[model samples]
Target chain A: MKKIESIVLAADLAGTAVFALEGAIVAMRHGLDLLGVMVLSFVVALGGGVIRDLLIGATPPNAVRDWRYPVLAFVTGLLTFVFHDTARALPFMPIMTLDAAGLALFAVAGAQKALDYRIGPFIATLMGTVTGVGGGVVRDILLARVPMVLAADIYASAAFVGAVVLVAGRRFGLSPMLAALLGGGACFALRILAVMHGWQLPKATPW
Target chain B: MKKIESIVLAADLAGTAVFALEGAIVAMRHGLDLLGVMVLSFVVALGGGVIRDLLIGATPPNAVRDWRYPVLAFVTGLLTFVFHDTARALPFMPIMTLDAAGLALFAVAGAQKALDYRIGPFIATLMGTVTGVGGGVVRDILLARVPMVLAADIYASAAFVGAVVLVAGRRFGLSPMLAALLGGGACFALRILAVMHGWQLPKATPW
Candidate 1:
C-alpha cells in the first residue's frame, strides 16, 4: 500500500479490533451467540461512519464502499470469538487504551473527510466528534444503555479539541501528516490519562 | 385542527400506536422498564422516516419538526404500560391489521415528501419503501435482532407498488389526495392479505 493507504489501513485495524472487543463484551453480557456477537461488532464499527456519510449525501458510504474496513472487522470479530475466554480474563486497561487510539484516528479521519468535502470548520469539528462517538452511541442504543461518551467523560470534547488543532495547524502551514500526528497524539494521550485517573467532567447540578 | 391537520393527526396517532405496540413486544421480550419501552417505541416510530428524510436532504426531518409524532408514541407507550396484560393478551391479528394501515400511510407520506423535494419518480418510490421500513429496521437492530424486512416478505415491495401507482395516477391527472388514498389503500390491503395468508415473494433460486 501507498503511505496514506497504509495509514488508513492501520487506523481501520485499530478501530475494528477495539470495536469488536466492545461488541463482544456486550454479547457476553447478553449471552448472544458467536454469530450475533460478530454482527454487533461489525455494526458498532461501521454504523456511525455510515450514518455520517449518508447525512452528508455520500452515497454508498465509506463503510459500504471500502471492502477493507468490513473485512478487518469480520476477522477481528472471529478472532475475538476464538479467544473469548482469554479475552475475558484480560483486564480492561489495555482494551481501554486501544479504544482511545481508535477514537483518535477516527476523529482525525472524520475531520479530514469533512474538510475534503469543503464543509465549514465548525461543521467539520462536529462531524469529527460525531464520528468519534457514533459507534459507541449506536452500540449503547442497541444494548439499551446510554452512550458511554455522554457519561461524565471528555471523550467527544477531546475529539473537538484535536480537530480544531488540526485545522489550526493546517492554517499555520503545517504538513498534513505532522498536523494529524500532533492532533491524534493529543487526543490519544488525553483520553488515556483520563481513563487511567478516573477523570471526568463535573455533573450538572440541579437548580 | 383544520381538516388536513385532523387527517394528519389521525394518521400519526394510528401509526404511533401500531409502532408503540411493536416496540412494547420487543421490550417485553427483553423485560425492560417503562422508560425503556417508551424510548424504543419512539425509535421504532420515527427512526426510519428521519433517516430517509435526512438522506433526501430534507431539513428538520418530519419526526423532529413535528412534536405530535413523539407525543403520540409516548401516549401509546404509556397506555401499553397501563394495560400491559391486556395489550399482551390481544391476538396478533388486530395488531397486524393496524400495522398494515400504518405502513400504507407512511409509504404515501414518504412518496409525497420525495416528490415535494423534486426527486424523480423511481427514487421517490424507493424513498417510500425506505420510510415504511426504516423505523422497524432501526428498532430490530437496537434489539440485537436482524431486521424483519430482510425476510421473505412483501412489506417494502408493497410500498414500492403503492408509490408507483400513485405516481402513475398523478400523471394521468388524478387528484393528489385521491391518488394517494388509492395507492395507500392498495398497500394496506396487500399487507393485510400477505400476513393473513402467509404470502411472500419467490425465493431466489440457489445458483
Candidate 2:
C-alpha cells in the first residue's frame, strides 16, 4: 500500500510540474507579467485536481491543503518566469512530451480518486477526462483562447480513453499500480500519436 | 426561516434564467449550433454556483443535483435558439437590466452560502464575488473574449462591494433576508450605474 501511494504521489507531482511549465510557457507567449505567469502556472498545475476534489466533496482540496503541490508549482513558475526565453528556444518535442505525460498522470489520478470516493464508473471516467483537460481549459480561457480540447487534436478523447481503461482495469481486478500504468501509457501514446499525425476533431462549419 | 429560504430560491432561479439568456445570446452572436447554444447556456447559468458548491465541499452541486436549474437553463436556451433574431433586435436595455439583477442575486447567494458553511467573512466575500462574476467569466472565455472581470469595467468591483456589504451586515447582526436585500440592491444599482456611465477599470500599461 505504501509503495502504491509513493508511486501515485511521484506521478502526481511530476504531472503538476510539467503542467506548471506548460502554463508558464503560455503566459510568456502572451507576454504576461510576473504575477500573471505565476498565477497561470499555479492554476494550470492544480486546477484539475481541485475541480475533481470539489466535485467529489473533497473539501480543502489536496492541492490546497497539501502545501507541497503549491510550493512546487510556484517554484516552477518562478523558474519559468526567470528563464522563459531560454525554455522557449528549446526544441518543441520535449515540451510536447512533458505535456503528454501530465495528461496521462492527471487522467489516471482523477479516475482513481473518483473510484476511491465510490462514484459510478461512468462519472469516474468523466471526472478523469475533466482532470486531464480541465486545467488546460482554464489556462486557455484565461489567455482568451478557445479551449484546445474543444477544437484541437484528440486531447480530451485521449484522456477519455485512458480513463475508461483505468476504470475497466479496476473492475477486472487489476492492481491499482498496473491499472495506472496501462491507462497512463495509453493516454500518453495516443496524445503523442495524435500530435504526430495531425489528428483533429471535426470543426463546426462557419456560418 | 422558510421566508428567507424562499427568497433565496427565487433570487437564484431568476439569476439562472437571466444568465442562461445572456449565454444564449452570446452563442447566437457567435453562430454556434443548437448543442453549442445549450452548452453555453448551461455553463453560464450554473457554472458559478457549481464552483462555489465545490469549494465549500457542497457535494453534488445544487446546480447538478437539482433538476430544476438544468431544465430552466435548457428551456431558456431553446427559446433563445428559436427567437435569437428577434431577441437580438430588441433594445439592449432590458437585457442589461436582467444581467444586473443576476449579478446582484448571485453575489448575495454565494456569500450567504459561504457564511452558512461558517467560512470567514473575507473568504465569503471572495466567494460571493466569484459566484457573481464566474458564470459571465466562463461565458466570455468560451466565446474567446478576455474575461470582462479581468479586462473590462467595474463588473467584479460591484460584486465585491455587494459581498462586503453582506458580510458587514451579517457581522453587525442584520437578518439574513435584510442583508441579502441590501447586498443585492447595492450590486444591482452599482452595476446599472456602471453600465450607464461606461465605467471601466484602469488598464495596465501595455508592455
What global local distance difference test value does model 1 have? Answer: 0.75
The parts of candidate 2 lying over 4 Å away from their true place are B1-42, B52-57, B63-137, B144-207
Q: Write the per-residue lDDT of candidate 1 for residues B1-207, one digit (tens) a residue.
A: 399778876886778778877887677668889898888888878877887777567857887898888888878777887888888788877878888888898888888777777766666766787788888878777677655564457787777778877777777888778888988999988888877788875421221
Candidate 1 chain A: 10-residue stretch with minimal lDDT: A27-36
- Give a tens-digit lDDT track for model 2, residues A6-75: 9778988888999998888889889999999898999999998888887777777888899999999999
Worst ten in a row by lDDT for model 1 chain B: B198-207
Which CAPRI category fits model 1?
incorrect
How accurate locally, in lDDT, is each candidate?
A: 0.75, 0.85
Question: Taking the candidates in order, what DockQ does each have?
Answer: 0.06, 0.18
lDDT of 2 by residue, B1-207 (tens): 888678768878888988998888777677665655766788899888888887776786776456688779979988877877666776789888988889988998899999999999999999999898888887877879778689788888999999999999999999988998899899989999999999888887998
For model 2 the local lDDT of residue B121 reads 99
Evaluate model 2: give its lDDT: 0.85
TM-score result, candidate 1: 0.58
TM-score of chain B of 2: 0.95
